[model samples]
Target: MLLAHPALLADRVREYETLSALDADEGGAAARRRMDDIAYSLCVATGTADVDAAVVAARHRLPGARVHDDSLITAMHRLRR
Candidate 1:
């Protein structure tokens, strides 16, 4: 599995969060389309099936992720092993 570059992942995560915070009417169709694109990219980058999960995974993969921060996915993955 190819990992996405940390910088690219960070950018996508920021873009997704920013778009998500907008009011539906404020963002409109263009923002919706862009959000969808960013969500897809994030899912692909993090190898996750859901946008929420993808976002969490992307954050954990970011450069400054705290070593002590054990997210759900990380915990689940650990249990699987």
Candidate 2:
């Protein structure tokens, strides 16, 4: 769903590859955090409530995928650039 969602701005394939690498390394907190940030960005871009709902639904489907709440986009957006 996230990949299919039109608001996703990052490269899905590259993100997935990075995530896979992080998982293999087993101690990639920074990489994992980036993945969370990307997920949150996609969710926020889709809709504010989407992240939570999608994570729940995705967990049910994949069962092993790690999803986290990285809801920083709103705050990031609010920052005066």
Candidate 3:
């Protein structure tokens, strides 16, 4: 969804990635807080919600992002389950 809407997501991705990098350096309490704020704002603007309370509520039920994706080698394997 984000890549599909670069005009709306580019800044967001950049912001999040920057925050993540900062956090990785061992001290980013404030930056991490700001990242959460930025994320909430971006999510709201994307027609998902426009209120902090709403954003928090929505995020509470949100699923975890996939850290990695696996490629399937065969349709048969995919449907084996």
Q: Judged by lDDT, which candidate is best? A: 1
Off by over 4 Å in 1: 24-26, 70-81
Per-candidate clash tally: 0, 0, 0
* lDDT: worst 10-residue window of model 1: 19-28
Q: Candidate 3: lDDT of 12? A: 60
TM-score of 1: 0.76
lDDT tens readout by residue for model 1, 1-81: 999999999999998888888743266788778889999999999999999999999998998797577688898999999
- For TM-score, the strongest prediction is 1
lDDT of 3 by residue, 29-61 (tens): 776578777767666655555434433433333
Whose lDDT is higher: candidate 1's or candidate 3's?
A: 1
Error of 1 at 53 (Å): 0.4
Candidate 1 Cα lDDT to native: 0.90
**TM-score of each model, in listed order:** 0.76, 0.36, 0.38
lDDT tens digits, residue span 1-81, model 2: 233332233354345456756673365677767777766654554444654554444333342344554457656878856
Better of 2 and 3 by lDDT: 3
